[model samples]
Structures are given as C-alpha cells and as structure tokens.
Target: MTNDPAIAFRVTALEDNQPNGREPILGGILRKKAVWVDESLCIGCTYCSCVATNTFTMEPDNGRARAFRQDGDSTEVIQEAIDTCPVNCIDWVKFEDLDDLRSQLNAKTIRPLGLPPLR
Candidate 1:
C-alpha cells in the first residue's frame, strides 16, 4: 500500500461505505452490477469473504476468488466484496446503467494511486 492519504482514505471509505457513500445497484429491469475477480492476480486471500461472505467464495481447486448472487442479498454486499479485494483485480460491468457503481468505486481507489482511471 502507498502512503498517500487519498489512497488511504479511499481504502477506508470503501471498507466502511461512508455516508453519502456509493450504493450498490440491485436487480431491476437493468441487470445488477457485479465485481469480476481475476483468477491470475488473486493470491487466494479471502479478504473479500471477510466483508461479504455470502457474495464471495474461494475455490478450493485454484484458490481463486469467485462472486455470485446470493438470495436476498443487497447490492451493498457486493460492493463490500469489491472494496475488500487486496489485489484490485475485480472489475464491474453495468448490465443496464451506463455508469456502473462498482466501476466507479474501483476508479476512486486507482485515481488517487496515480493509476489510470478505468473506463
């Protein structure tokens, strides 16, 4: 992790979901957004599971992380999984809205680290 305060703040905010914080989108006519995990980058750490156990799971075979839609789960749970990702491999795709909240959250973390903002 970097010593940048902005990066630190983003990490904390993502973990806590600050007030006026971004909300995860749920099922609607538009498909609910999801966080895609990168199997290659994942170290098999279950950090995401700590935040949203229902949304994320570790595959015993590859030690890669997986995300799925759980019954009665809200969008926030998904966001929590994305936020907790240590390697930052998760990518969010919008099913309906042009602007996906999951992508935006990822952007915030990258931008402060001087990382190219995701499109």
Candidate 2:
C-alpha cells in the first residue's frame, strides 16, 4: 500500500477494483469513518444524490440509495444528505460503531409517507 506522507494515510484505490462506481469512503492510518444507507427505508428521492453525489448513488437492482464510498465527499456535505432524507434513512458512523448503530434502527419508528406535517 502506498502512503501519502502529506495526509499521513495509507491509500487504497477502490476505483480500479470496484465496477459499480466510485468508492465513497477511504480507510487510512489516521481517520476511521463510514457512511451507511438503509436500503429498505430509502425512498430513492434522489435528494442525497443531489446533495452528495460523490458519496451516494441509486442501487441498480432496487433503486434505493446506497453509499459506495465514504470519502468521495466531505463529511459535512454527506451529513447534509443524511439530515435532509425525508425518511431519515441515512447516517454516518464511526467505522467501529456501525453494528451498534444498525441495532438502533427500528422500522416501527420510521415516519409514514405523505402524512400531514407536524403543527
């Protein structure tokens, strides 16, 4: 693995191996982070794609939004997409905290579609 001394991170290019598209996140010696998209809850609204195109894309088979890579865009931009998801299906997590976050996602808590806005 090649190291970028400036960033102090080991570079592993996913673009060459992954056929689906650009990888969103990159792991390195410094930072450990990840972005997770709940496909079952995704509405395919394209909002996330618009806000953080580099980080997310629609799955070819299901059309739900998916995060192919975590480092394609800035965390702030990706967070905006997560916050704006009408269904609240997107999230960011520490690389080690992914499983814990998954357990907290309960379908019963998901907001129903086309419901009247809160007063």
Candidate 3:
C-alpha cells in the first residue's frame, strides 16, 4: 500500500434530487474523513451509487461497496454520497463546518439539466 496520505482515495458528496419525490436539496459533506465501508454493515444495496455513481461502485469480487473514484476531494461530492447512504454507515467529522461544503454542493453558478441558472 502507498504510504503517502495524499495517494489515498477520498470520497465526497454531489447533491442531487431524492428519488422518493422529496424536495431537491443540497447534501452535506463527510469532511476530511473517509467513508468507511463496513462489509458487515452494508447489505449490498446500491443506494450509494444511485446518489453519486461517480464516487461509488459495487466491488465485483466481494459484492460489497467500494469507492469508485479517489478524485472526489471536494466537499460537494463527499456529502452527497454520505447523505444517500441508506444504512447510515457513512458519518461526518466537522459537521459544524459543512456550511462551506453545502455552498459548494448547492452553488447555482452552474446549472444542471432541467434546472435554470441562478442570476
């Protein structure tokens, strides 16, 4: 394994609409902490992927959850993944500091499809 801390993978949130018809809201971040995937805790449900497919994936070998990309160092993507975790296995540190993360996740500068840009 790489001894370099920067070489390690990181997960972040990317806020999106809830599938259950809930109000569209920006999710929070998991802070500098990594989302620990507990094999025993996970039921193999792809709820995480459903929210942030870019950051999460099902490990084919173990049929468990794993990080899909390590490029998610931003708070926006990290929080979205954590919010979507069905089992609540994902947790956050510096939860009080998430205002910045929330702003980044919910920033209206760049509008997604079907949404209008914020003036």
Report how far residue 64 has shifted in candidate 1, in Å.
1.4
Give me candidate 1's TM-score against the actual structure: 0.48
Which pairs clash in the backbone of model 3? 12-77, 12-78, 13-76, 13-77, 13-78, 13-79, 13-80, 14-77, 28-79
Residue 3 lDDT (model 3): 72
Q: Report lDDT per candidate.
A: 0.57, 0.72, 0.53
Q: State the lDDT of candidate 2 residue by residue for 1-119, as single tens digits.
A: 77658664566657666322234545533345689888768877889988888988887655778787667776678888888899998876687877666676543354444446446
What digit string (tens of lDDT, one per residue) describes model 1 on residues 40-111? Answer: 567667887666666667766556676654322355666766777788876675545323544553464322
TM-scores, one per candidate: 0.48, 0.56, 0.43
lDDT of candidate 3 at residue 82, scale 0 to 100: 75
Per-prediction backbone clash count: 0, 7, 9
Error of 2 at 103 (Å): 12
Candidate 2: where is the Cα deviation over 4 Å? 1-32, 97-119
Q: State, as a TM-score between 0 and 1, how close model 3 is to the true structure.
A: 0.43
Better of 2 and 3 by lDDT: 2
The digit string of per-residue lDDT tens for model 3 on 19-118 reads: 3312222354333554445444555677776665655677665465656453343446557777777787555535354455446534533222234545
